[model samples]
Target chain A: MANTMLHINHIAKTFNPGTITEKKALLDVELTLNEGDFVTVIGGNGAGKSTMLNAVAGVFPVDSGKIEIGGVDVTHLPEYKRAKYLGRVFQDPMTGTAATMNIEENMALAMRRGQPRGLKWGIRPMEREMYREQLRTLGLGLEDRMQSKVGLLSGGQRQALTLLMATLKTPKLLLLDEHTAALDPKTAAKVLELTEKIVAEQKLTAMMVTHNMKDAIAIGNRLIMMNAGRIVVDVSGERKKNLTRAEVMGLFEKAAGEELDGDRLLLS
Target chain B: MEIIKLINALPGCVSQGVIWGIMAIGVYITYRILDVADLTVDGSIATGGAVATVLLMAGVNPWIALIVAFVVGMLTGLATGIFHTFMGIPAILAGILTQLSLYSVNLAILGKANLPLNATKLELLISQRNVRALSLDNPLIVLAIVTAGVIALLYLFFGTELGCSLRATGANNAMARAQGINTNTNKVLGLMLSNGLVALSGALLCQYQGFTDVGMGRGAIVIGLAAVIIGEVLFSKIFNNFALKLLAVSIGAVIYFVVIQVVLWLGLDTDFLKMLQALVVAVFLAIPYWKGKYFNKKTGKGA
Candidate 1:
């Protein structure tokens, strides 16, 4: 068996399809990730990078095609229903976690994601120790402040907490939609380091979308570049490790058959 | 002394307060927890009273009649929920639609504008006649126990997994859905729960007052909002626990009724009471908004 963890089959999506402002956001996109494969995605503005992530996350229905996670088809699943099989962290720090809830409570919710919630107490006494231990791994001294509301935390701390919540249950597929983009550079590096540690330790299959070319090149086992609703370039393993920004730009120009002039894709 | 007369009427005020307090708690669930200003209570309260009064007239047990009223109130919430979620109507408009439709429904249930439960013929749980009666028959004692029970049950329920998800849905729908909770379903469930409690309180009120009128619930949402706001303003600092917060709401309702009785005793025209209440609630509601806008200036100058 191929043991593919995520398979996006010829997916297509459009925004305001019948209007003058209609934009085809995704165009017959296909991708497959095997177990332990961490893929980084890069694209410029108006590209389909975030749309592809949204499509997989089921933020809205794709116009056509199917998606499968761990061999189970989820094309028709609503966002919440699909959440059972995937862990998603959004670009906005405020998007990923409930700010009004305490840290332990947020973790408890993630721990039971996809499980049928019943009348049982949301956070059992025994789960506290486990939550503390998990928070300790963040190295933010958050373990001691488990009862603090998440809203009191800084943007960086909230993003880190959101990352922990996403991975706490060991989801079959993890989707990162520029999860670190809202942080200071220092915090971004720290969050990315934590991301690497968790994914490596758990051997999680993940796809991360980023605007930073260097970060995209450096973070994952595989790299794919999207443009105008299609993946234009893909590289993996030894070839991906040695790739440089200039060469990647050259590859984009050659594949896209145009000068790489989008100001949104940060070469630095 | 005027104060002495107000003191003499305190027990009656407390009994009425106890009944309205339960209704206010129901409003709290939707207004505070579910974050929707559900107008269903205005109609559902009367629906509850109508059902209970009609059933009691038919010689049904008061306890069973209360449950039936609660179930009917839940149906009103269900209608509003379906209107909002399934039909894609805005939550406020959906509630208004339910409230409007429930006018005819309440009338149909009672077969008139009002129905009276004769205390001598009907077996009642609590009655205004016994409000001054210092015994187990007193409506105050029964209502107090019932309020305490409700507060205890609500405390336990909110601590549960399902309840937490419902709270999360109110707090943040985006996050709730991302965690695999169906926000629409939770919204509907919350409305149902809120309206159910409102109806139960209505049933109790009907029996206590010995009558159910179609117009009994007019301006009821304001009363519920007044109770909630007053409770938060006065007891929020002291009541940190969820259960204590609910208790504060009950206390708030008591204070509200006591204040009204004082106003009545003070010889203020009774016609102006509703306007006075509207102004009081409006001012209180404005305080937080004003604090955020003007008092908390970024320059840190004293207001």
Candidate 2:
């Protein structure tokens, strides 16, 4: 059995369809993730990593495609309708938290997503303890500062919090779109480490898009490179383990029929 | 001083203040909380007032009319929210379109450009006259009711799951979504609740003013923004709690009205009201940036 947590088949997305500005952001794309599969996606700007994740999340209608999670077809579902099956962390740290709300309050929101969120279960003591335990796992000393506004948290802390939020319900898949690129080097490393820890602990099938080739190779079980709206390379198993930055660059060049452009792939 | 005359007009100003202050709270919901500026409030306010007046004229109980006005306002808000989230309309543009459409809707409901309630025959405020014992114009009683209603609602809501999701949608729609919160639904609900309150304010306002003019909601969003800015600037430290946000906004409305009244008393022509409103908002809006840059240089805090 495939045991796939997610599958994207024959997906295509065209922006500004039929207009002068019409652009093909994603051309016929196909991918599948076995349960517990940790996949890293790499691409140049406009190469469709984000677009693929967006399609899976149903941000907008895919020009053409079928999306399935846990054997359920969701090609026609909207973003909100599909939310119960997926957790998404945006590229912007600021995009994942409410600034004025206290940390616990923010978490409470994340904890209650997709359910009929109501006043009856507004973070009881047990839930607070649960949140504290989750925060403690992050090892960011956030357990003690549950009342602090999330705005006060550093980018790394917020990203980590977002990671926890994404996995809170153990959805079939978690979509992380360069969730740590904006942070400082130290913070990025910490968040990435937390990302690894949570995915392993939860055994979640996840797709993370990263600009950092080193981290991509270092973190996930599989790595896919894309250029010109299609997957250029997909590596996994022992092959993925033996991959290096140079080999990945070579694959990109082969797929694009060109030399690797000036280094935009984050090297850390 | 001219300020005393402004103070004498305090009730009228505060009455207007609370009315728009509630609208400000509505604005704050969309603008500050939901990170949306649902201009539907401008129309929703008139909608509320129009509903209240029509129902009152139809011999509905005053309180029932108030509730109906709120429901009508919420429907208007829902329309805007649905357009923005489901239809993919930008928030600002969505609000503008809804506001424009509401003008026709309001006229349709009122059967004309406006509706007027005969204040004398209407049930006055409890403070102005005892319901059974006395007869006095009771705008203050209604003011207290609105103030109390807003505060209670805010307190009750911020603690709810749906409510928190709504707040998170404003703060971080992505986060809200990742956590299983449907931001679109929350945005729609938040806008509805916000404009609903604003509509209530409008309903009461029309009753208090004895008339509902088609143009009464002109620049309503600005007034609401002004009240919210002023309140946050003046009471940041005092009302940091979610429960206090509504009260602070109410006071902001009162303060805004008082300032306008004072200016009007000082021989400034009423024609300058709009200009003065802009200047006041501009000054207050600059405060945070000013404090962040200059004042904070020494004190280590933003304006």
DockQ of each: 0.80, 0.57
- Full-model lDDT for every candidate: 0.91, 0.82
Model 2: lDDT of residue A196? 88
* Predicted model 2 interface RMSD: 1.9
lDDT of 2 at B200: 87
Candidate 1, residue B169: Cα displacement in angstroms equals: 0.9
Most TM-score-accurate candidate: 1
Q: Residues B171-234, candidate 2: write the lDDT tens digits.
A: 7666666666677788888888888888988887887777887778888888999999888878
* DockQ measured for candidate 2: 0.57
Question: When superposed on Cα atoms, how far off is each prediction in RMSD?
Answer: 1.9, 3.6
Ten contiguous residues minimizing lDDT sum, candidate 2 chain A: A259-268
Model 1, residue pairs in steric clash: none
lDDT of 1 by residue, A91-111 (tens): 998888888788998999899
Span of ten consecutive residues with least summed lDDT in model 1 chain B: B294-303
Q: After superposition, how far is residue B51 of candidate 1 from its true place, in Å?
A: 0.9
